[model samples]
Target: MKIQVSTELLDGCVLALLAEKDYYGYAITQRIQQTIPISESTLYPVLRRLHKESWLETYDESFKGRNRRYYRLTKAGTKQLGVIRNDWESYKHNIDWLLKGDNHG
Candidate 1:
């Protein structure tokens, strides 16, 4: 049986946050929970991967004398969000039809 969340889910969460703000790792970790709750450990790797792939960009800021890495959507990331959001909508549409559950999603 297919189980566990997919990497696409990780990408979706990242795209959602990047669309919202330039967030530090900790802030991204927290904001992602609003929709897709995931652990700090799980998130760092995904964020790293996205940044490495050039889909996301990172910048630093001084907050209380500490430099923190922040993540934001690159042009690529913004472009990908449109594609991914369409895919997600189609997936949800089919799933909703089959399940007939509340459209809380």
Candidate 2:
């Protein structure tokens, strides 16, 4: 069964990817595909939203005879990533505890 991925989780993943290096839409989608099952349609809006939020910056580079827009994380994006990481950590901890049937009083 395919599990549903949340929007916040998707945003965090995209931010983390951009944190590593700038990538075009296709490349970002490909990299994300390695770990999660996401499509171009889903990723494009995320990119647009991030850019609109000032968490991401874009620049176009001439590749061969075409232009490719690349995305990079901004200072805000890095900070956002940090927040997401912390949230994920806490969430995972709680879930793990619940799954392991460990109830501490």
Candidate 3:
């Protein structure tokens, strides 16, 4: 479904990924792309900023002789995700009602 999303949606999507599991950059990028409308070249910056803001933590994982940095939500990040999810759920409900009303009109 093509749901209307705000710019802040990316942050929420990233947090959602962390909620699901720790993800490397590539995995998170793919997951976000699948779930949300990511802006041009915005993924890395968002991840970096989230980490810089202490909302995320990173560690390296090694497999098949290669290592990549994976990200996980911090305690604060989980709290922020909860707040964002609540707000977005309300937004989604309100907008869904609006669109349905428009359809009937």
Candidate topping lDDT: 2
Q: Taking the tens digit of each residue's C-alpha lDDT, what string does model 1 give over 55-88? A: 8998899989999998989998888888888999
Give the C-alpha lDDT of model 1.
Answer: 0.85
Candidate 2 lDDT over 1-105, as tens digits, reads 787889999999999999999999999999999999999999999999999999999999999999999999999999999999999999889989998989776
Candidate 3 residue lDDT tens string, 1-105: 776665577788888889888999987877777756665377888899899978899999897999999999999999989988999999889888887886574
Better of 1 and 2 by lDDT: 2
- Which pairs of residues clash in candidate 3, taking residues 3 or more apart in a chain or in different chains? none
lDDT (0 to 1) per candidate: 0.85, 0.95, 0.84
TM-score of 2: 0.94
lDDT of 2: 0.95
User: Regarding lDDT, does 1 or 3 come out ahead?
Assistant: 1
Candidate 2: Cα lDDT at 13: 98
Q: Judged by TM-score relative to the true structure, which candidate is superior, 1 or 3? A: 1
Clashing pairs in 1: none
